[model samples]
Target: MRIAFVSFETVYHRDTETSQRFRTVCELFAARGHDVNCYCAGFWAGEESAFERNGVTYHAVSSGTEARSSFLLRLPFVLATASPDVIHASAQPSSQVLAASWGSTLARAPLVLEWYGDDGVSDTRWSRLATGRPGRIVTPSELVGTWVREIGADGDIVDTVPNPIDCERIHRVEPGEAVDVIYARRLDEGANLESLLLGLAELRGRDWSAKVVGDGPERETYERLARDLRIEDRVTFVGDLDLEERIAAYRGAHVFAQTADHCVFPTEMLWALAAGCVGIVEYHANSSAHELVEGWDRGFRTTSEDELAEAILAAGDLEHREYDEAFAEYDRSAVADRYLELYRTLQEAQGLL
Candidate 1:
């Protein structure tokens, strides 16, 4: 299948969880013998406006200003070039959605918008518009699947697809000694790292060191708080680890705890699990995260500092999951095959129409 990936400013702007997931998914398809092309904006991996990434072509159209980076003006040009069988984009309603709709209209290709995280509480303003029109809606969890239906999207068109993890790579690091606890996230950007540091301080010398990975705006404040908590000596702020090292950390770490409030999908938790950290997250526990984890083993909820500390210790004390109880269908290759089924279904639907 010929696929055109409608990317956002993210393709070239920064390497974020969302952008990286999109890249990984597209690359998965590309690597599996599908013809894939990525369309981005301004400076895409040293390619002019267009370049190929691992056999998948990536194009960056000029989005006028660097700030907003809306590619509304470049839609037609991108459509004319690739003329894909399907245009799958990430995120909710954005210029990418509009472009995908327009490009599909012009080329008669199906447009599949892969909605991973909820934009705010509900779908964004643009999402309503996109759903009101015709397009295939893909969600990462069954929770979002219901929401899409509630919004009057075609029930048959809505598909549930989980984010694929690099299981082989993450699990390659042999599990050895298990560290007590780990909290992985950029310390800044309202990532809720301060609370984690304070929580760690509350449990210092309990034979656990917090692996404070990732650097951010809150580094100084977090470090200072660690000192204030009188747990500075015990904590190891190892900064960010490369992909391999991160997988190793996950393999060796016991508990993975972070506070993302109530975000729909926390990618870090997925990574932590791939690395074999029993997950404890402090989400609102009312949204999709709670729903995704419903009935799933290896995950628990912690809503307060005391609860977080207790949960961390509990996870730490628990024995590592035996092979059977440990593995879920959410692994990398498993997820890729699921998405492939979705792609084939959407392509066939477009072909019939």
Candidate 2:
């Protein structure tokens, strides 16, 4: 399949979760032997219009990321030139989707929009029009898909394809020294670690230790909260660990608590679940974390600090596991297959298959 990825700003222009996800998908498609080309503002240090890396080709729509209007003006022509089988695009700067739609029409290709919903969406006329332009829309979770539909996209075109994880790595990495509980996510205001800390404080009498696995602006605030709760010694602030280290922590811990106030998809929670940790997700109106464990036996959902503490206690009754096969559906290969399936389906609908 010849896949064209349209993004005005690439990961090189600005390293963001959305940009990174776009790049990851392009690379995955390329690795799977699909001809993948990305159209974005040039990130390489040269006047080159095109650059090749990791079996994927990147075509510069503009010299750099500063000129958004210029990128939009030139994007359609550049994308049409590729004559791709399918056009996959990021949903930020929503107007880009509008331009890509023109390009898809010119190229006679189907357009699939990827909306992570991590980046804030501006409610403008352009955005509304862009929402309805894509033949298909993909989101990390149904929570974001609902928002996409509410913003004017047809629900029939919106699909919930989760963020992929390297489950094989989780299985290969040996567990580190066992801990009682674990919390992983950037310590930002949205971290909502206080809920987990307060819950742990309630169980001070229990001989258990926790490991906080990320660092961010709110690190000191959370550390101070732990100290104030008198659970500082029991809760170790380990900062951010690389993939393997984090997986080891998840495997070593008995419970993984997710309390983030905002999350398009609970990625770390999914990792912990795959690593065999009992998943405990706090119900936040904005977070889609609870969707992962709605009916799972090894998962628990809670609404308050008291309930969080109770879930942790209940998790102790389950036998320790090093891996869970249920989450294999979210593996990188599995998720990539989902994208491929969508692409082929769209191609078939368009008589390209």
Candidate 3:
């Protein structure tokens, strides 16, 4: 099948979790003999044109200026050139969605809109998209599947496919001698790194140390907070590790801390769990991190900073148990196959089979 991915940002624009997931999906499809094309804005380097990587092709519609207008104008032409059998785009109202809908009709290809449970987007917007062009909606979780229906999308068109993890690549290794607690996220304001820092500070007298990974706008702020907490010497800010270093940190850590307020079973946490690291997630009103630890002995859900601190202090006592079965379905290959099934079903429904 020829697939065209329509998005405003590419993995290069921001190596974010969502963009990387899209890249993985395209790579998986391309590996299985599908002709995949990505249409999006140019990289930060501002190269506006078409390029190819692995088996997938990339079409950059805009440099770095006037993103929405540029993308809306160039989308139809790019779609005409690529002419894919399926056009997959986000349900969020962006230039990509509008253009993809137009292109799907112009090219007569089925449109598959993905709902990632972005709370910022209104239900009315999703309802409008669902009423158009006869298509399907793909969600990464059952929560999102229900969300689409509540927003007036048909249940018959919704597919619940969870986000994939590279399980094989993130398998467990024997941990190091020192009890290490790890936290990985885009150290931004919303990340709630302050909670984790406070928790670590409370345990300054303890034997365990921490490694804070990833970098963002609030890195300096977080560093200041760590200093103010007087645990700066115990907590090391290892800003953004490459793939190997990331895996190594997870594998070596005795515990992994998650304090983000709005993530849903984040891929990094899943990786840590798969690598045999004990998981402790903090509960926030709008956060779904607790849902991942529900009914699991290897994972703990805490409701406050004090609880998080207590859980971290108890990390050494928690026995190392393999929870690999819980995350097996999240493997990248497994997710790709699920998406393939969705694509095939859509194609068959449209009589393209």
**Number of the top candidate by TM-score?**
2
> lDDT tens string, model 3, 261-291?
8774477887778777888999876566666
Expressed as tens digits, the lDDT of each residue in 69-104 for candidate 2 is 899999888888888899999998788999999999
Top candidate on lDDT is 2
Comparing candidate 2 with candidate 3, which one achieves the higher TM-score?
2
Better of 1 and 2 by lDDT: 2
TM-score for candidate 3, residues paired by index: 0.81
Error of 2 at 181 (Å): 0.6
Estimated TM-score for each candidate: 0.82, 0.98, 0.81
Query: Where is model 1 more than 4 Å wrong at Cα?
Result: 8-10, 42-49, 60-81, 90-93, 116-125, 141-156, 174-177, 201-205, 285-292, 321-328, 351-353
Error of 2 at 165 (Å): 0.8
Clashes of 3: 1
Give each model's clash number.
1, 0, 1
lDDT of 3 at 8: 77
TM-score of 1: 0.82
Ordered from best to worst lDDT, the candidate numbers read 2, 3, 1
* Per-residue alpha-carbon lDDT of candidate 1 for residues 154-256, written as tens digits (9 for 90 to 100): 7877777767766666646665345667777777656777666767766876767667778878888888888888988866788887867776777777777
